[model samples]
Structure formats: C-alpha cells, structure tokens
Target: MSTDAAELTARLIRCPSVTPEEGGALILLSDVLTAGGFECHRVDRNGVPNLFARWGAKGAARTFGFNGHTDVVPPGDLGSWTHPPFSGFVADGMIWGRGATDMKSGVAAFTAAVLDFVAATPPDGAIILTITGDEEGPGRDGTRAILDWMDQNGERMDVCIVGEPTNPEVFGEMIKIGRRGSMSLNFVAHGVQGHVAYPHRARNPLHALVRLLDQLTGAPLDQGSEHFDPSGLQITTIDCGNPASNVIPETARAVVNIRFNDLHSPDSLFHDIRAKADLVQAETGVSIEITSNISGESFLTAPGPFVDMVAEVVAEQTNRRPVLSTSGGTSDARFIKNHCPVVEFGLVGRFMHQVDERVPVEEIHALKRVYGGMLEKFFS
Candidate 1:
C-alpha cells in the first residue's frame, strides 16, 4: 500500500486554499481520510475552517498527532510565475505552484504516509491529524479553534509534530525543536506642538522617542542561549507624520519587534522597557505610553525519546543527521506546545512564499517515505 505524495500535493495546490479560505482543500482531505477508515470532524470556529481526523479509538493509550496548515500566503505578481499560482503544474521534475514548499507537499506527504501505514500494518495505537486553514493570517481561529474543540470533545494526542517547512536548504537538514518568543512594542510620545525656532516653547516628542529607542538597542538582550541565538530587537518603524520642517509634531510613534530566547519572558521585557521609558520621560518631560502584544513564548522539546526517534528516522532515510534547532520565527507549534511536546519538520523552505514557489517531485515522494518511517518507528 503506497500513496503518490506528489500527486496528492499537486491536487492540494490546485485547491487555492489561501489564508482564511477553505477553497475545498479540507473537503478534499475529509473525503480521502474518511475513505481510509478515519473519523473526520469539521471544527469550524469564528468562521475559520479546521479539520480533525482520527483513526482508532477516541483516546488510545498511545496516540501520535500531526499538525499542519493548508493556508498559504497570497501569491504576489501572477505574471511573474511561469505557471499559474494554482495550476499545480509539474515540469522539469518539480511541482510548481503556491504552497508547494511552504507546505502543501508536507501535508500531502504525511497524509500519504499515514494512510499507507495503517492500510499495510495498522498500528497498535491511534493517529490524529489537525489541519487548519488560518496559519498565514491573524491565526485567531485556526489550530487554536481545533485544539479548543478537541479539549471540549475529549480528544487528545500524546505527542505532536507540526508539518511546517523547517529545513532551510535541503531535505532532512534541520528540525525545529523550539522557537524564540515573539512580541511587538508600540510607543507613543506626546508633547506640545510649536514652531521649531522656539526651542523653549516646544518639547520635541521625536527626540524623546529616539532616546528611548537608542536605549533599547544599546545592548544585546543576552548571549545566545543553549538552543537559540541571542535575543533580537529590531525597530520596525518610527514615524511622526510631520511634513513641515518648521513645526514640531505633538506626538511621535514607533514600533519595535523582539524575538527573544528562554532567558526572557514578556513580562520581564515589558518591565525593562517601562523602566527605560520612565527614565526618558523624567529627563525630557515628554509623556511616553507603551503597549505590547506577545505572539508566543520561547519553547524547547528537550532531547528525549520522541525527538531522538524523529531524528533517527530522518538520518536513516535521508543520510543526513538533522540539526535540532530553534532558530526560526514562530509557528503553530507554539500553540501545540501547550497541549503536548511539539516539534516541527517538513520540506526545505528556500522558496516558500516567494515567486515561482515549488518542490522537487522526488523530494515529495522521499518525504512520504520519511514520514512513513516515523510512523513505523513510533508504533513499533
């Protein structure tokens, strides 16, 4: 019993399931999984589409889970593509389309692997698939919705794997054990507006904001942690919206994004920034207001049995020992980490969310074999 992963990937690519749109991708997967003897459920919440499919009993003693998103970033500049973004065109031994490497291929591979695995040797345990359609968007209603539904419905998974593109350059080269915490801080400094020539009449809010930003970026947050690089603070934007050189603006606004490691939490970082803003305000008399939103906190699935098993399978199949890294941006694994130990592995991501996104035909098939091997090792 074998599944053609490339063919399945092509079919998925043709679905046009961009962020927040089902585009028939979930419907197609439901039909296939149901045919393969799995129970399927549509866990739609707040108008976002999610699918939960399981094989075996509701709560088996040992259950393996796979998480992935079918939604893709919008394809930019259609004319720039050799083939239509949704064409799923295969040429020169590659499947060319949007979501090819970003991860329709990965979903296809695991789906194929699990379907074939059960048909051939039915594992003693259970398998669960949580596929979401809102990863590329605001993500308020995608996998989170499915997990909420799962908790309410008494569904559980022992360990989970997120099928996100973790490899940067080649198949089996990298696996994400964790991701850095992410947050954005928005600052607004208010002062009296006046003519630039009257230095005493107007307090320049821009000056105070610049000083605050300078303080924030003056030092490294920390030396690189054990599994992660040093925390990064990047000032994404600074604006006063003032056009007149002679007039000082009343308010200046800026935003800084931080990718932090386990050394810091959102509270600690916010407190530190608050202290800095307080000092700047005292020195300059400009009222400073700071607000922050946290995307996720840093997490690591420490080296253990499940992690070793996944690494061993990839090494044996691809002859490449994957580096267990936590160097990438956030993913849905951040949400899954709260439920169970979660890690990310999938196709090389060099071309994801780019023009002419694609994946090699052979790589898709190889990924299926790797996923199938993981299933065998897990249940053995």
Candidate 2:
C-alpha cells in the first residue's frame, strides 16, 4: 500500500512544533524513518531540534538529498480560523492548520515518497533528509548544526532539494534557482541637545539623518540583473524620543534593510552606504554610527543537468512549465547551498503563513508523485 501522505500531514499538523520547540514532530518523523530502514540521528544543538536521516552508504558516489522544516510560525489570534489552528481538521477535502501549507504537508509528502521508493526499488545511491526545528526562528543552529555534525561524521550530498513552497499560484508554476541577499543596517546619529531658541548651539542630528536617508533612497540600487530584479532598499524605522516640540534631541536613529542581487555583496553595499554617511556627516557636522548584519548572501544553482531534470519532472507531473526564479525571501536552501548544489520546489504557497493556512489533499498526493519521480529519475 502507498503511504498516505495526507494522513501523515494531518498527524504532523497535530504536533505543535513551533520554532525551537520540538512538540514531538521530529520524533514522530524519526520513528517512521527508522522503521523504514534508514539511519536516524538527533542533531539537536543549543536547545534547537534537528533530525538527519540517511539510507544507503555514508559517502555514496551519488547521493540525493531533501531539506525541510516542521516548525510553524505561531498562530496569531487563534479565533479567526475556520478550524482550530492545530486541529489538523480535514474538511472540504483540504487539511487546515498553521503549517499545512508553509510546509508540514511538503515534509509528509516527501517522507512518504522516500519510504515507498526505498521499499519498492531501493536506489543504487543514498538518500538524505535534513529536517530542522529552527527555520522560523533565528536559524543559527538548525540546518547549520546538522551540516557541522555531518562534516565531522563525513556525510555529504551531491545535490539537494529544499522543499520550500515555490509555487505562488499553482502547484508547479515556479522553482527557485537562486535567492537574493538580505541585510539590515542600523544607524544612530549623535548631536548636542539644546533649546530651540539657540539654533547654533546644537548640531541637529535629525537633519543629517534625514539627508542620509534621502540620499540613500534617492536613486535605484540598480536597474535589474540577470535572473533577478534590481536591488531594493527600504528605511524600515526611524526614531527620536523627544516629545517636546521645543527640544532638539541628542540622538536620532534609523534602520535600513536591503535585499540585493548577485551584483552586490554585504561588504560592497556597506562600503558604499558608509561613504554616503561619511559625506553626510562631514557636511552636517554630526557623528553617525553604523552597524550591519548580513543574514544571507545571494546564490544561484546555474541551469544545468540537475535543474533541467527537476524542471522536467515538475512539468511532467503538473503539465505546467516552471519558471526558474530567484525572487523569494530566503530559506534553509541558503545554508544547504554552502554544502552542495541546491534548489527549491514544493506546493503552491498562496496561503502559507496566513490565517486558515491549508493545502489541497490532491496537491499533497501530487507532490508525492513528483518527489517519487525525482527519485526514479535520479536513481535510474
């Protein structure tokens, strides 16, 4: 009998695995995988849960891998749902829950497919599944920790697929070949405080901050790049605590976030922005302090045999030619990319993270067949 992916999804949805909290999700998966003849390891670190399971040799010549996360974002104001957020309610032929679409369904489908694949026609190569509980959290230790452990244990994948929701409108409309880089810069402008009547006594930092912000947002970062849209920059927040209209605040704060393409790197973007800040400070005589954090760098799995094969499989299954896109925010694929060639494809993501998030039962089954086809093509 084929593994029931929809039922597995419902069972997983019943697990309350919110970020950094296992909620029995990984354990449930471990039980199923271990029983299916795969080696399972709990690579939990720093209070975050992770699972690594493999079938076949440790260092096989040809290894196909899959990555996904079970942790769901918190269900905000639970009263708005048609069914309880964690009820795993199956009605109208759709599974309703917080992670039903964002990814519990994808995980269930792939897990079912892998189990059936190995049970029927064990591949000549190995298969690895990396599931993390920290994807929706800070993500410092989820997949990264598993990868670190794999390095020490001498385990690696030749190519990996991250089952993030890739289709925006339909089940196989898109595949992620690359993702744009993301970073944020925080700026604090310092000036002397003084009375409003004495304009010359204080260097107004807010003036310099406004100018710096205007300078940064005045022009486009770039027109566009191959396989990516132009870089985007947004001033997310600005603050000055002074309540009195007559008082000149001593400090002004602003935060800017940039989502960039391959044409730029964090260092390059920071240098250019800092120069603008320096120039503004020199002209305005206000000290500006800038600090930055690079979340993930842009990367691409160039169109080749692996990409072509995945696309062909998707087109074959859904009868829709998928577009190779790099427009989404980011995923664990960013981490996996550092280890091996990685790409992302999964269910339609129209309802992910929204109230009453769900996936069609048929789509879940279809995703299994697609993943099964991937296994067949890879091992043949």
Candidate 3:
C-alpha cells in the first residue's frame, strides 16, 4: 500500500515541530520511512534533530538527493487563526496547519513519490533524503550537520532537489536554480562621552554612525547579475541608548543585512564597508568596530542537463513551463549547493510563514505526480 501524501502532511503538522523542536515529527517520519526500506539515521546536533534516510547502496554510479525541513515557524497569536494552528484539519479541500505550505506538504509529496517509485521501479542509482529540524532557527546544526556526517562517512550525491516552497503564486510556475547569499553586520562607533552643552569637548558617535550608514547605503551594490537581481543592503536597526536630553553617548550601534548576488562575497562586502567606515573614522576621531556573520554565499547551477530534466517533468505534469528563478531568500539549498547541483521546487509559497498557512489537497497530489515523474525520468 502506498502512503497518502495529504494524510502524511496532516500527521506532520499535528506534531508542533516548531523550529528547533523535534516534537515527534522526525520519529514519526523515521518509522514510516524505515518500514519503506530506507536506512534511517538520527543525525541530531546541539539538541537539534535531523533525519537522514537512504535507499540503495552508497557510492552507486549516480545518486539523487532530496532536502527538506520538518520544522515550521511558530504560529503567532492563537486567536488570529480560524482553526487551531496544529489541528491538521482537513476541510474545504485543504489541509489547515502551520507547516501546510512552507513545507510539511513538500516533504510528504517527495517522500510518498520516492516510496512509490522504489516499490514500482527501483531506480538504478541511490535515493537520499536529508530532513532537518532547525532550518527555521539558527540553521547551524540542521542540514549542515547532516552533510558533515555524510562527508565523514564517505556519502555523496550527484545532484539534489530542495523541497522548499519555490513558487510565488501557483504550483509549477517556478524552480529555483540558485539563491542569493545573506550576511548580517553589526557596527559600533565608540567615542568619549560628555555633556551636550560642551559640544567641542566630546565627539558624538551618532553623527559618525549616520555618515557611516549613508556611505554604506549610498550606492547600489550591482546592476543585477545574469541569474540574480541587484544586490541589496538594508540598515535593519540603529541604536544610541542615551536617554538623557543633554548627554552625548559613548557608543552608537547599528546592524545592516545584505542580500548579495554572485558578484560579491561576505569578505568583499566586509572590506567595502570597512573602507567606508575608515573614511568616516579618518574624518572624525570616533573609532568604528564591525562584526559580521555570513549565512551563505550566492550560488547558481547553470541551466544544463539536470536542470533541463527537472523543468521538463514540471512542464509535463502541470503544463506550465517553470521559470528558472533565483529570487527567494536562502534555504538548505545553500548548504547542498557545495556538494551537488541543487534546485528547489515545491508548492506555491503564498501562504508560507503566514497565519492560517495551508495547501490545497489537489496541489499536494499534483506535486507528488511531478516528483514521481522526475524519478522515472532520472532513473530511466
């Protein structure tokens, strides 16, 4: 008997696997997958749960991998939901729950498709599933940990599909060939504190901080790359905590987040910002300090055989030629890109991370068909 994707999605949603919490979701999935002939491993790291399942022998001539997250963001304000966020209610031809679209459904669809595919055809190559629990949180211990373990254990994949919700408005409209990199920088300007009335006695770090921000955001990062939009930098927060009306603060802090294209890297951008801060420091005596965290670097899997294969299956299943896009925020794809050619495809993302998140029952079945078709083609 084949597993129903909709029922599996409903079962997953009811687990309350929010962010870092396993909430029994992985255990449930491991049980189902183990019975389906997959070798399952509990790849837990730093209290974050992850499941890695594989079908077929390791180091086969070819390997196909799928990556997804079981965890969903918190459902905010219980009163704002029409149905309880974790109810997994099946009504109105849709599954109602927090992870319905942002992607318990994606996981279910792919899992079911793979199970049915192996049972029916048993592909020539390997099938690997790397599902993580901390994708919505810090992300340091989720997919990254699984990949690290794979490296140590001599596991490899030729190509991978990330089941991130990729379509914006409708299913089959988009497939992500790549993603822009993301990094955040915290800036602190330090100066001597003094009374406001004696303006000459103490330098106000706020003034230098403003100039530093202006310098960073004054120009565009790029004129858009071939496969990406222009890079963006936004000042997320600025703070000078002095509450007194007549005092000059010793430090002014600001945070800037940059979503960059292939043309720039975290190191390059850091140097660029440092150059601007250097000018501000040279002009004013206030010293500037910058600390940065780079989430992932931009990557692209050029349109080729693997990409063309997935796109053809999507078009055949949905009759819409999916656009190869690199427009969304980062995902586990960022980590997988280093190991293999990766693309992201799943349900429409219009409801992801929003209140009353849901996915139509029909779309779930359609996605399973698309994934199943891909499996047939890839193995054939």
Give per-model TM-scores: 0.99, 0.99, 0.98
lDDT of 1 by residue, 1-380 (tens): 57788999999999999888999899999998999999999999888899999999988989999999899999989999999999999999999999999889999989999999999999899999999999998888998999999999999999998988889888999999999999999999998899989979999999999999999999999998888999999999999999998999999999999999999999999999999999999999999999999988999999999899999999999999999999989999999998999878899999999999999999998888988888899999
Candidate 3, overall lDDT?
0.93
Q: Residue 179 of model 1: what lDDT?
A: 95
lDDT tens digits, residue span 46-164, model 3: 99999999999999898889999999999999999989999999999999999999889999999999999899888898999999999999999999999999999988989999998
Which runs of model 3 end up more than 4 angstroms from their true locations? none
Best by lDDT: 2
Clashes by residue pair, model 3: none
lDDT of each: 0.93, 0.94, 0.93
Clashes within 3 Å, all models in order: 0, 0, 0
Model 2 C-alpha lDDT per residue in residues 307-329, reported as the tens digit of each score: 99999999999999999999979
Which residue pairs in model 2 clash with each other? none
- TM-score of model 3 vs. true structure: 0.98
lDDT for model 2, on a 0 to 1 scale?
0.94
Which candidate do you rate higher for lDDT, 1 or 2?
A: 2
Off by over 4 Å in 1: none
